[model samples]
Target: MNFDDQPHRRLNQLTGEWVLVSPHRTKRPWQGQEEESDRATLPKYDPACYLCPGNERAGGAVNDQYDGVFVFTNDFSALLPESPDSQPVADGLFVAEPEPGLCRVICYSPRHDLNMARLGTERVAAVVDAWCREYEELGVREDIGYVQIFENRGSVMGCSNPHPHGQIWATGATPMYPASEDARQAVHLREQGSCLLCRYMEQELASSERLIFENDSFVVVVPFWAIWPFETMVLPKVHMTSISEMEGKQRLDLADALVRLGIRYDNLFQTSFPYSMGIHQRPTDGGNYPHWHWHMHFYPPLLRSRSVKKFMVGFEMMAMPQRDLTAEAAAARLRELSETHYLESL
Candidate 1:
């Protein structure tokens, strides 16, 4: 079947959800909203920015003057280490439970102007190392069940700051999405005797259609069931359950993949591409999950241009997630984009 030219639904094997893709709709004119891209240059250090080194944050805490990767408990953490430890209370229809967790922010660089895209591979590798270390430390905690590391870039993605940083939220209970993925991977392993993403990666490698860029350790691809306009997944070439499993070379390779992908994203539309990126790994809830395979997901909003973005509203919110661009087509566009950032290319 010609998926690129027809309307079809693709199954997200990890989540048991379907994404409706109507490739024909791409030909239609878009009279929708167009955002004004932020092209203003950011200073390397902003005294007013709370995340800058040595600056006093809103929480009235002074940051240390660290030169490289810096991590600390979030001044305003979404999750706290302390909470009432009690069983879920049930009274008639209402039920509630106390959730205890810890949230931390990791600054990728001392230079606020440099993001992952602009940061060299060495710098990016430091970020990866920090990620692995954070995962290992946080995952070992008896109270922590899941450690979620994610970054929200650009104002459109609800990122309040432009500083190069990401967050880690370790929770007492696993979140819904990761839990669903764990279930699916477990079932896949039990039924097929192989990792779900490993099998899926084998297929993606076989048919290079959906692949964007790949290194020795990782490959970036627009998933078969991508809902975003340029959604990409970074899968390890080898089977692994968590980031802590990464060795020296694997860490460098993964860093290379991230920087290269970030450059392509920025070069695609000649802007610092906005997206939400996160890592999903094994749960810390003490399960021998050989089925779990760690992967990174990048969900970008841009559609045809830097200003034009995909919006999830109406049917997408009421019904199911849908997209106009086919995954193959998106892959082709990204694959061809110059890895050199557009600003630098000029």
Candidate 2:
């Protein structure tokens, strides 16, 4: 089949979802000259940064001298332990439920200058361990049903601080997005007698076109139906429904994959890449999710350079998500990037 001649193809998996892949588009790489001048360097430590050691936070609480990974309640939490009882308000057209959850921040490193790429595998592994511990602790809460660990990097991603860190939100109910995926996977597993994501991972491995990197226990690839330009997913080669279930070796491999992929992202434009990344796993509400697969999704906005970003406007907001570049092409570009950051070796 001449992929270039085809307008678009909707590849359907065992699950009823479809991804629109337009292979004919020629997404010419943008060369924005202004990005060269806009590159900024972050300091190793900032005296005023709240996340740093000995700095006073918003409520007069001070950060301790945390040398490695640090976990703390968010200074300005979106959700608190003592939220007022749920008050459901219903009108003819309006309805709402009180949203309740706990928000915490995990500092990836003490050094403000260090991003994920420069954090090294050992330190990244430490962060992974912290995540596992947090997940275990939060998941046991009788009220909590879901735990979300996510990172928003770079100023373009609206991150107020340059410190390498991520946020965790443990909620009382499963989110709509993950709930949909869970329902789909459950249906597929009941019908096919196999895990949905495990089968998808096998298919991706066999296709090889979208694969970027692989370790003993993980595979980093651009999904065939990616919406963002540099969107990628990291899947565990071995089927595990949640982070808590991962073996020590698999956990370490996850750390390595994250570090390597993050370094590649930074090297892509010779700038700190802006991205929203998070892990997707089975709900903590406790049901046999043998069919569910754990994975990570990275959505970066930078399309041409550090300054230029892809906007989800017009057709995307009204119609559906669209991308200028094909997933295969983007995968190839990411595959070609070096895992080692250029700045780190210097």
Candidate 3:
């Protein structure tokens, strides 16, 4: 039976969740909502932008005149580092505990116009190095259980500023999705005596059906059970526990993969593609997790054209996530896009 022609559900091995896919739905008419394109000609540096060098932020803190990548504590952090050690026990259903953590913002570049796609490979490597440093430092802290590095690109993805930047949130508690992924990976290692992602990556590489792009050290593929329309995962060929484990050459190769993929994404829709990208790795709790295999996830909302987007409503909120595009079709779309940026091509 051809899975692409029929309505079916696919299981996510890492998170143990099912996603409903209906390939025929893509042929239906689009009478739903459409979003305005946020793409525009941006200046190299915005004087009023808080992330620009030597500018005053919204929280009244002035940024230093730094070059290249700049790191600083978030002006308005979500988690307070000075949270008191206290727990309130409830009668039966309610229980709470104080979470002590810290947040940081990393300015990818002083230039306000460049996203990862236009940011040359050399500068992208610098960002990768900064991620390794932040992960290593935060992982050693006694209070931080998980260090999450993520970026929300475009206004639709909740990015308030257009500056090329990302955030690192070190928290005392592991987030829900990562917690589920960690559990499933550990179970796979114990039961099958192999890493979960490593095995999954092998199958993807063998077929190349869902494979989009690859470098010497990393491979990007639309996972078979993707919930988002253009969701993809960057899996390292070699099994490593965390971002810190990447070797010198591996770091550069990973940076290449990122730039190429970003360019393809923007070129595919001929606009600034929006996505919520994040890296998941071993927890910072100093536990022996040989089962942990680090990977990066990209969840882009654009389903069809630049104006149309996939919203999670109705069935997704009440039951489970659903998608009209199959993984193979999404990969084929991405795979055919040029690695060069569209503006350069024109």
Candidate 4:
């Protein structure tokens, strides 16, 4: 079947969800308004920015004037570290439980204007190292079951602070998505006698249609069931359950893969693409998850241009999620974009 010219559905093995892909819809011309890209050059250091080094945060916490990577507990954390433990109260019709966790913010760079694409691979690798450290520290806690490392980039993604940083939210229980993935992977392993994503990665490598880029250790692809227009997943070439297992050189390769993907995203529409990127790994609840395989997902909203974005509305909200662009088509566009940032050309 001609997937690029037809309407079809793809299954998301991780989440057990299906996305409808209508590739022919791309031909429809858009008469929509475009958002004004924030082209104003930001200063290297914003003294007023709370995340900047040596600045006083709103919570009256003073940041250390350290260089390179920096990490601190969130001044206004969503999850509290000192919440009292209580069993889930079941009162026939209603039930509730107390959740305890820790939230931390990791500053990717001291520079306020730099992001993953502009910061280069070495700096991104440092961020990766910081992620590993936070995961290891938080996972050892008896109360923490999962460590979620994620970044929200650009004002469009509702990122309050533009400073180069990401967050780690370690929770007392495995969240819904990860729990679902764990179940799926476990079932896949039991039924197929192998890891789900590892086998899927091999399939993608053999097909090469949905693949964007690959290095010595990692491969980036627009997943077969991507909901967003340019959603991409980064998977380690080897079968691994967590980032903690990565060797030094493998981490460097992952960093390089991220930077290259970031550069391509920026060059795609000549804008610093906004997306919510996160890593999904095995739960830290201490269960042996030999079936789990770690992967990072980049879910970008941009559809046709910088301003045009896909929204979850109407059918997507009341029914199942859908997308106009096919995964193969999105991968092709990403594949064609330059690895160098657009600003570098000028």
Candidate 5:
């Protein structure tokens, strides 16, 4: 049975979850009824934009005019540092506990029109440095257990602000995804006596069918169990548990990998791509996790075109996650795109 012409379920080794891939369903045609996000022209600096440098935020806090990158605490943080400890002592069905943590925003660039793809390699490296600093700072905290660094680009991804930025949510407890990964990685280490991601990276490198791009330090590939059409994972070449472990040269290589993938993404649909990007790493729970290997995931919702996007509904909401494209097909499409930014051609 050829997987390209059949429907099959793929297992995600990290989370031990399964995804349905219907490669034959790609033959279906769309009615062009999907929602299209605005691709309007943006200025280098918008005086009214709150995230722009020197602009006053909604909470009456003014941003500094510093260059390069900036970091600030979220005015409306979902998690707080001073959450009171409270939990039900009884082992009941509706038990609850206090979730204490911190949230901060990292402005990738001062230019409002620029995203990571167009930020240039140097500026992207600066952004990477800021990420490393924030991760280390938060990881050393006594109250923080996991630091989630993620970015939701474009308005379609629920990003209210147009400025290029990402948020960090440091929690006092390990979240569901990371917790699942930890348990699976621990189990794999016990059985195979090796890091799970490290071994998986080796396998992907040997196969090279689903790989999109790679650098001296990082490799980008569409995961075997990818649910989104163009979902990609960036894995470090070496075994490292978190961004804090990256050295000077590895950080620059990561920036290079990100820029190449971002450019390919924009060139694919000939528009500013919309996606949710995040980093997955070991929990900062003060425990040694030799099994963990840090990685980044980019889950782009676009399916066939710039206007059309893959939506998670019906079965995905109530049952299992599904997708129409195969990881190899998606990787091939991305790999064929030029690394040079499309706008740079003009």
Candidate 6:
């Protein structure tokens, strides 16, 4: 089957979801100049930076002199713990629930100049340890049901801060996306008597076309059903449902995978790559989710050129998500690129 000829195709494993990949229309060579900018050279220590050590935040709270990984409650949290009970308006059609959750910011390092890609493997491991601590602490809370760890890099990704950091959101219930995945996995497991993602990972590993990089513990691949041009997912070889369940070595391996993938992304455009990345794991609702698999998603916006980005507009907004590049092709390109930063030579 010529995937290029087909206008739309449905992914069977993902509940028959369709994506429009207009490869012919977007088959153009990249023509963007790589320019050096002072913005990339972040300061080692910014006295005025709110996230830096020994700095005062907006709410009159001061940060301690943290050297390694540090996590603190978001100065401005989107979800508060002291929310009132959810109220329903009209009938069951219109309902609103009070969201009670915790938002935390995890500082990757004391140095502001280093991005995730630039941070050494050992330093990245420290960040993973901090994530484990946060997950365990927040997951134990009776009020929390899901823990989301994510990073938004570059201004294009709507990140106001340039510091090397990520955010953690622990909520009262499983989110819509994860809930959908959970349902699908459960259905697949009941039908096939095996885990859904585990089976898919096995197929992907055998194909090897969509794979970007892999170590003993983790595999980074551009999923066959990826919606973004440069989208990728980092999956664990072993089926660990949540970060809290990860052992010390697995945690370190995860951190190493993150740093390596980040370095590749930065090298791709020779710029600080903009992406919305997040992890998907089992919910903390106390039920055993043997079907669920742990993975991280990286969604980058750049399409044919660095300056020109793909937007979900017109048909995409009205209909379904679309991409111009196939996942296999994207993965091949990323695999060809070196993990080292292009800017390191300059």
In model 4, the runs with Cα more than 4 Å from the true position are 34-38, 85-87
lDDT of 6 by residue, 162-217 (tens): 88899999999898888888889889889999888888899999999999988879
Clashing pairs in model 4, backbone N/Cα/C closer than 3 A: none
What's the lDDT of the predicted structure labeled candidate 3?
0.91
Error of 1 at 66 (Å): 1.1
Tens digits of per-residue lDDT, candidate 5, 1-346, equal 6779899999999999999988998888767754443355689999999999999999999999968899999999999875455554556676667888989999998899998999988999999999999999999999999999999998789999879999999999999988998899999999999999889989999999999878899999999889899999999999999999999999999999888899999888878899999999999989998889999989999887887889999999999999988999999999999988888866
> What would the per-residue lDDT of candidate 1 be over residues 49-139, giving only the tens digit for each residue?
8999999999999989989899999978888775555567899989888788989999999898878999989999999999999999999
Residue-wise C-alpha lDDT for candidate 4, range 1-346, written one tens digit per residue? 7898888888999989998888888899878876654465678999999999999999999999968999999988989875555568889989888788989999998899888999988999988998998899999999999999999998889899889899999999998988999999999999999989988999999999999989999999999989999999999999989999999999999999999999999888888789999999999998999999999999888886787788999999998999988888899999999887878755
Best by TM-score: 4
List lDDT for all candidates, in order: 0.92, 0.84, 0.91, 0.91, 0.91, 0.84
The regions of model 2 sitting more than 4 angstroms off are: 9-20, 27-39, 82-84
For residue 125, model 6's alpha carbon misses the true position, in angstroms, by 0.9
Per-prediction TM-score to the true structure, in the order listed: 0.96, 0.93, 0.96, 0.97, 0.96, 0.94
Candidate 2 lDDT:
0.84
**Alpha-carbon deviation at 153 in model 3, angstroms:** 0.5
**Alpha-carbon RMSD, each predicted model:** 1.6, 2.2, 1.7, 1.4, 1.8, 2.1
Give lDDT tens digits, candidate 3, residues 305-332: 7768899999999999999999999999
Give candidate 3 regions above 4 Å deviation.
30-39
Off by over 4 Å in 6: 4-6, 12-16, 28-39, 84-92
TM-score: which is higher, 3 or 4? 4
How much is 170 displaced in model 4, in angstroms? 0.3
